[model samples]
Target: MTMVTPGSSPSPDPDLVQTILLSLRRKQGTWVAWAQGCQTLQQAKLTPQQIFEETGFEPIQQNQIVVAEQVYQSILKAGLSDKAQAHFDQRGSDLLYELRVLSQADRARVAEFTLKHGLEADEVRELVKPVKEYSYRKENPPGFGDGPGDAIAFHFWKLARQKDDLQDRSRLIAQGLRFADSDGARQQIETLLTDFTVVKEQPAPTLPLYRLETETDLPRIIPVVGQMPLTIDDLKAVPVAVPENPFGMVTFSGTGAWIAVPGWQVIFQSEDPVGLLTRARQLPNYPAEAADEPVLVIVDRANREWQDDGYFLVAQAEQLTMHWSPSPIDAPILGKVVLILRPKRILDEDYNRQPWQLDE
Candidate 1:
């Protein structure tokens, strides 16, 4: 054998070493290099081939040494196994299984813990997007015992008693009336009666009393009037007209002023023939005194030749010749002439009147 050089170092490729170690760990069910292999190497001072032989690990092929060197460098970059060991310890293999098997009590405990840690269930559920349906159901389980209405009534009654004012108490009674069933209404009424009765039954101081009159008599009375009969001729004498110009003068002659019948005219030798004929159709009757007066007349001169006639009398006036003007006229005329008549104030007269009666 040739004499070997002392203190000469051999360069071992890191990739080749890591590949060998990884194969050995997989086959042996452990990361042997990082655990037993690295420890043995530090203590024994053996070459890679010697270590493989001594540990029963296979030798890496010469062609695969570069791949092994790459893997070895990666393993070194990933650091130690202790960090991984700590992680596995904290989150054990059965974490998901534990969550799956959790009871209602366990879920409540989790919810409480989350709340204590400032992680609200409502907020978390909103964020998670697609949460398991069962989780939501567990969080909001159905309530037990008495319905919501009873709780509401109890709180309302408590608040009413705290206020202790009569109006407040009355309002509470009204609210109870609105919500209560027949039996509940009766119960509430009885409760109120019992409370008030207790106060009334207790002894109390007396106050001064005053006596006042409570009854008196009052009289009722009605008035009476005498009746009078009227004839057709008397009714015809009443002044009535569908006035042409309500404010303008209406003049009549012959029997025109004495009869209330419509349509009569004055016959004067100098009068316009067309105007007289029109007037004959619109006049209201007046009495003997009015007949002697100069008649007030409204002229309808709309038709250029006076074909449109003015109002006229139905009957002949005995002696009345009336002249009317807005201002004073000479001896035969009058100023501001207004026809005055006593109104017939009979109730239901229009309803009772016949067609012939209207003409009368």
Candidate 2:
């Protein structure tokens, strides 16, 4: 086996180095004997002489030897011998051998070791104070009645919902509502109510609409279809005019409003009839693929803030089908008005659910 040279940037095995250092630190007597008997001290070719000269230290002085011996004795007295032995047994012995070769730096290393492992009286107090404070907080949680019991229940409910447990979701909602009724939980209750209403009211469309090109050889005129409920199959069968070049041409209404092209699919119907009509006038294209079922179309009458005031029938159409036939101007479509009314019983039920008047 080749002898490994020290301090030569050799690929030292970390585990071997740890093991050696640990072993050397543990067996103080063995380490001292090895240091005294080191025949290869000169061959180690260390910077000890240069360091000693720079520091102006007399290497053979009796006082220096006494100081070194006292420092080692102090480390031994601090029970470092047993601790170092344990570290060596657990790690390795090469590290201790390396430490022994560093004569001047060994004193600093010993001082560091003592500081790390040996706690002063003040250090012990510093460690205990925070732990005591934490214990107090645990015993007394913030807020009044039952001390964080409801908060704990809410946390558990939330954790349960994350696990996709429907039962836990319902439980949490119920618990949260109850907590809201409590004097201390009113603010949290109001926040939850706002979130529920916002989520429920926001409508997300499944199909996207596209823009229609006017000048392209593709069909420029799309038939203004009726509000009649037509399935996707019916739409597919409806003949459309296709342009030749199919490029750069955009479709627009007489009033400068951009009409949705015939190709896009209709994904959702607005509950507001006026909003639907406004949306229809603005769409330029439709979705290509849609479900085969006809969706409900409401003639939105509530929000009419435009100069072109009229009813709009919204539906999904293919994105590439250029020409629309049987225009909205036909005689049969002009004379009819479709009204969808809510049932009287349903209206009455909603009315009954309303909050009581101030007088009552």
Best by TM-score: 2
Candidate 2 TM-score versus the reference = 0.15
lDDT of 2 by residue, 1-360 (tens): 012223444444556444433443354444333232121221334233532343332333212332334335444444455655454333322222222212223323433333344534343233222222222222322221222223333333333334344555456556544432234443443344334332221222222223222323122456444467977776766445433222212333344322222231222233333111222222222343432222222233333222112333322111111111221321111111122111111224465458878974
Q: What overall lDDT goes with each candidate model?
A: 0.31, 0.32
| Model 2: lDDT of residue 237 | 62
Q: How close is candidate 1 to the true structure, as a TM-score?
A: 0.14
lDDT of 1 by residue, 1-360 (tens): 011111344534566555545655455433322333433342344554665564554333211332222222333343425543343233322221222222233332332233333444354333221122222121221221122222233334433444447787667655544433245533644376337422221221221111111111111111212235767776666444333331222334435422121222322221332222222112233332432322223222221221111221111112222222122222221111122212122355465345654554
Angstrom error of the Cα, residue 264, model 1: value is: 99
Native-to-model Cα distance after best TM-score fit, residue 5 in candidate 1, in Å: 73
Q: What is the lDDT of residue 163 in candidate 2?
A: 37
